[model samples]
Target: MACTQVLLLICLWLSVSDAFTYLRVHNKSEVTVQDHWFTQRLDHFNGADNRVWEQRYFMNDSFAQSDGPVFLMIGGEGAANPGWMTQGTWITYAEKMGALCLLLEHRFYGKSHPTKDMCVANLRYLSSQQALADLAHFQTVMTEKLGLGNRKWVVFGGSYPGCLAAWYRIKYPHLAHAAVASSAPVKAVLNFSEYMDVVQASLSRNHSDCPRMVKLASDTLIELLDYKENYIKITKDLYLCEFLVIRSEMDISFLLDTIAEYIADVVQYNNDNREFEGVKGGNITIQVVCDIMSNESIGSPYDRYTNVIQTIMKSKGEKCIEASYQQFVKDMRDISWESSASAGGRQWMYQTCTEFGYFQSSDSISQPFSGFPLSYHVQQCSDIYGEDFNFPVVTAAIQQTNENYGGLNVQSSRIIFPNGLIDPWHILGINASLSSDLVALPMQDAAHCADMYPARPEEPPVLSSVRRRILELLTEWLQL
Candidate 1:
């Protein structure tokens, strides 16, 4: 505690800090490599226009073993900050295992903003290929920059980014020593039918407690789809107001998505007597299937049709409120309810239906309830018409068939793909082509992002086991 001793300690700390300054990347787009490390603007590759990149590095820091295997921690989606992967007990444990962690933000989603306009006009720029390229470039730069030319690095991600982790290793076998893909959907792409079908089944299985509400919403949606007027009328009634305009181009597919998602969440939560919180929990339900569905900006199927009607009237300067069910039936069309029987098609059923082991499409009419991702665009369509629509943007992107995504034939080093048995997205695993390179872990009673359970106390033992394995694998990988 003496001033003289404290001053000496401060001097020692400053010297150590200087020694620890391994590398730094500059805005001038250059790669500066030194004896123990290197830094560079990852976007400057091949002198080609940089696709909005980030810096990556490995260090033999004060705590890390200089001669040990170097580990790269790749977080999922919008993890622009190094502190992003703060959750998951296993993730924390992995970092403590002496690995030099590296995090990269997926383009357009976080700090790695897309160079192009992110509006609907330029949404196509944020495809998976661009992300894959960013990862590959980061790997090459980090390896070469810090004199880690011969060091081993690992890849790790959860949810959407987890898909990137799997595809990354398959695309560039030489870049990573191993990969840990948590709850990753590597084959779903344009086929969400399997996922939707699962959600529907989940809703149906819980019908005992909220049977009347569930049936009413589902029936209302089906009936509204019979005709455009009826659909608009129903939407207006549900919305309790009138707006001007309508889109004949708008398929009943949107309605179907609302109905299915509403019944699944609300009905199931009611059956379990578990409380469902709104935006506070970062969730909003679209419908009230027994008050179970989260608050969706668009309301439920019954309310959805009503909102449409209200909008149409409002736009036309008419104050029409009530829409007769009989009048609705008179305007019905003869379009057969789209089926998910087809394997690979552009139908909603094909796009959202469970592939159950094949990359088929779901041409069903229903949509997802979550608004942040696809659900956000689907609901917005009821009020506005723009390129921001999720359906249209994805409709174009999916048509491209990202062949390079799953093109490699090499075996993956170490990877784990977990899914929920009852979770809708789990169906993508069915279509997943599992080989020695991939390991599929499915939880029997969980839902999307369920791996965050067990560690969160709301999950089961199997979930905990998966978390434990991830830590074990990460520790082993880092020490290797």
Candidate 2:
């Protein structure tokens, strides 16, 4: 083809592609109080054309026209339900502070399903980088479609979204006026090693009188590790003896991690499960960690172990008696005693261990872990053990924030990081930059998000101070 003809074809392709793939925004509906939920569609960067990305946000109380600072709310993992307690609770508070609230659901969660096939396809795309991009794109859409041009908003979030909030300001400091990260993971990845250490320290510090109990707990773990084979043997036996059933599909780690987590919980677990028949009245203190970690196995450890031993002996026949169990026992004992750092005793120890690169297993192929998605397992075990379970994605997200935010050379832009002292996830060990624009508030006994509590009769004194600081900063920010 001639040069002129080739140029005309290229131009035609560019125009057609732009028209087809450019981002498009549509207004869905306006709520009673000037709040509107809108959806936007954007073409994927990769040429995966079938995947149409969609995101939603709530614009409340003059977000489009507000001269005051606008509040953009970013939620943590699996926060698809827009009406969840935290978002709902803070909506009115944002309005009261003279700020328009914008709540955006993280992609792959809630109504923000950007792609289909959640398990196989979407899970791969669900990362901190993509989430940050989605938020940025939504900001641009809101600016053009809602007439809130050139007005920067403040980003806020707790738990997982806190990391996003920090990243938003870091990545687009010019787009955000300020940022407020509550219970944010703005430093390291979620280290299970550090988290378990916090749990162990908390237990020992809070319950010094239970030294004997702690020692017994430690000893039990050592014994279990030492007799991994025999322990499995006995557990199998016990399960079969009770139910007269024979199933060799037992996962020993499940039992160990479950019991480990149970022991971490502050409360004692004294239940009447058929599996614990042999040790029903035994002095081993059980807690919620064990129960939550334990999958629904039908039999007891005693029966399960016995069956395993019997099977092994039967299979070996004459050779079984001559087999040296002493070496195996010694190795187990070694792993049990030496491998366990006191910091590794928390119920969510696996999460910190995997994320912070501190976990080691004698046998390969462990359970799926990292204490993510904040399911019932985390909520029950963490709450029972006095351990806070936040979203795990915050780990990578925070590192990105620090890298970008620290390099911005931003001045006159303030960042307020609020955290609860008792929030074991963040672990009361963070070093904030000593800049005039940054303030760190460590609230006492506040748990996680301290701003949403009604002053209670049994509340800790620090809760009052936390509440006070939150009001002070927010009120001053709003000029209320």
Candidate 3:
């Protein structure tokens, strides 16, 4: 978690964009979401009249009355799924209140591209402020269209979008009655190394040796990178598909990411009740990792690590073991932007490069591996995005974010910040109250966006209390 702040790019592949993972196991049934679009402005702050684009959204009116609350789920870096309206605690809350459910896609993400292309010139409209405006406008249009303009509304989102939900209530207080921000990292900082610290703590919770062997295997990989003689065995030991072509350090870092993916995935999804109620060990969970670590017959700690890596890679169906480390290292002196994956990773990277600055650099030696240099990520702002993404520009943007949104110390009312105690990104969340109205719940035995997902069988008592509190708050706020 140290820098893989892609919580804008969840997994590290070029195509992967779950940067901050929000599970959307959407089961399509009868097309509940009536997909629609709003004519949104390209630049809410600067665009003139007629400078418009379509923003994607979905609405479900099953539980709606002529006069009822609207439950809005704010989509983040990934595509908006219809399941959000059907699944999750919010839908249940919506059901109880007979509220209409709506899902608004983030502008640069899903099918809500506001510009012709994701070029630097076009992506200027992809700021958080603009996205918030999109929500405000969407609400204005939809509520009015359905003759529900005067009715109360409640917004919801988890992870990065969670930050948006919190900030939305803070900024656009008149648009919605309350918001539920699950694991929202409101604070945008340059160095977010605290992620791995939580990872360390989570592993340590299971058994002392879990994080220890992870570190040992990391060190072994680092030591293996230096010796030319060990190259062949390195491939064989890690079960490489081909001879090591890239720098061993990059390969080592990528492999470390591969390893981190396993540990992080388990901790990220450690809400066992959601997947397995009382079972001690569930698939791809912390217990499973610990079970792997406990296997003494797996030979040395390195071999145990190898077995885990093999399992992870095979699950991903990876044929080769090379890192795409060279893409960001290109000379920015002669760089041109491309409209590739900008709707997803490239757009998230732009947001990260500009405001969040949560680069997942493997700089800390005490951690597993140096994933990427900060400059490599910072430069990629211009390398792939635009020239305005340099360090100076991004630094100013971060300050603006903190000043405008109150990063980590949000002063909003009627918003609930719920963080799973085990989530690596929890370190960035508000685990306490800023005021009587701005409350936070550090949900125990949870990970990532645990509170955002639908409740499961025998849900943890803390989660039950959280759900009850949110429902109560939203109900009370709307009635007032």
Candidate 4:
């Protein structure tokens, strides 16, 4: 959650894209989707750079009408799966409105690689500014190629792509007529300590004692870590792949951060049972975690904590928990696309280091978790990239992001910002409606990107109503 090491580990266990938090790809759909490609410039800002790459996009015009709107689902930090063209709430909206649906894979993600490899030099072109330009250029090309003259365009994205969706509307208002930014973190911060605070709140909201147990477990782990002799005991009890070795503070922080992420993963995607590329999401809720922590028969708080880790690991078919700092650095340093860590993890880490400092740390005393500090994340950026990407550089980048985008006070219209109250990322999103056209719909008892998924029979009534309202707004904006 803090760096590429934790992110890659989460990606492996959760089988979800780190670029878009919990953005699932459904395998089955009623509509037929086709993949297409267009020539996209490597550097949109540079006039001298005539270099180009084939950008991949998916299209489903099954329900398109001559004068209907275009529904553009922007792909985030993952591969653009064609499943999105046939499924999701956007597809349903497209069906009803007779809109042409499109899913543009983000450059440098999936198969849309802009360069040869993810080496440090090639990654310079992989920024939000470049991505936004890619969107704008794609819009122009699509409008001309498809003869969609003056037709209204609606953009939809969740998580990081959601942030892009909102920013797209702000930056290129004329291009995108309306936008649906779900669980979008518009505000960028260096120390995202509030993420864990929200996680704590989500846990405590389910059961007050859950946070207490979690804190007790963290204290116990810290105590064990303080004594060098307890390394083997800690490693064996936690089912770690290797014996604990505390060469530096980061080594200890890596283990603790990873443990905290097990809880964060559940909290972030709690009860959002959206299917991902044929895999159904687990129904693991805060209560599920709380039930484990509060069971007295499960031994001490430390035992319950280890149980939580083991349960998640076993569910994901992981043999042992990876807590080695050297392994983390090794995986992160390998910039090859063939590497396991190259699955948008390194790219996202670069973005976090250079653009959005979404460094989730346990520095705050308000949160139940501890051990992972802001320095741990900052050190990761420097470790993976170079000394140039230090704390001061990261801080400056975050400040510039806020200054450029206007943070939560983003000036945009005819865009709907939907956030889940229980989601940790909601802290950076717009929770209040800015105006008549700029609407914010905050869903209670919802997790990250809940509204983006297709409607299910067991879904909350409020989620249903929220989807309906989104359609209603789009109808008004497009004047259909």
Among all candidates shown, the one with the greatest lDDT: 4
Candidate 4: worst-modelled 10 consecutive residues by lDDT: 5-14
**Number of colliding residue pairs in each model:** 67, 35, 11, 0
Could you estimate the TM-score for every candidate?
Answer: 0.58, 0.56, 0.84, 0.92
Candidate 1 lDDT over 60-127, as tens digits, reads: 33224455455454544332333333334433443456445455655444333333222223333345
- lDDT value, candidate 2, whole model: 0.43
lDDT of 3 at 95: 73
Candidate ranking under lDDT, highest first, comes to: 4, 3, 1, 2
The TM-score ranking, best first, is 4, 3, 1, 2
Mind giving the per-residue lDDT tens digits that candidate 2 earns over 1-480?
A: 111100001111113222222122222122322223334333334555433444545444432235655778885554333342123334444545555567777665544545432222223455555667777777876666556665657787775576677667767777776777676655443333444444444444444423334434334443544544654543443232221111211223333333344333222111211121122321222222233223236243322222333433343241232112222222222212122211122212322322322222212112111222223223322332224334443345444544654422333345667666545445522325347556677765444554433355454576567556655666665442
Q: What is the C-alpha lDDT profile of model 4 across 1-480, one tens digit per residue?
A: 122211111111112122122222332354545556667888899899777777888877777789899999999997887878777889889878989888899988887877767778888889888999999999997787677898999999999999999999999988999999999999999999999999999999878999999999999999999999999899998899998899999998999999899899898888885675454336566888899999989999999989888887776667888899889988988877788777888888999999999889999888888899999999999999989999888899999999989998878799899999999999999899999989999999898999998778876567999999999999998983
Worst ten in a row by lDDT for model 1:
1-10
**Candidate 3 residue lDDT tens string, 229-344:** 88787778776556655564544555556556666666766744443222233345676676676688997777777777666566556655543444323322221224345437
- Per-residue lDDT value at 469 in model 4: 96
Please list the C-alpha lDDT of all candidates, in the order they appear: 0.44, 0.43, 0.71, 0.85
Listed per candidate, the RMSD to the true structure in angstroms reads: 14.4, 15.3, 8.0, 6.9
Model 1 has a clash total of 67
Q: Is candidate 2 or 4 superior in TM-score?
A: 4
TM-score, candidate number 1:
0.58
How much lDDT does candidate 1 score?
0.44
Candidate 3 displacement at residue 353 in angstroms? 0.2
After superposing candidate 2, which stretches have Cα over 4 Å from the reference? 1-51, 56-66, 84-93, 119-121, 149-152, 211-215, 221-250, 259-412, 428-433, 452-457, 475-480
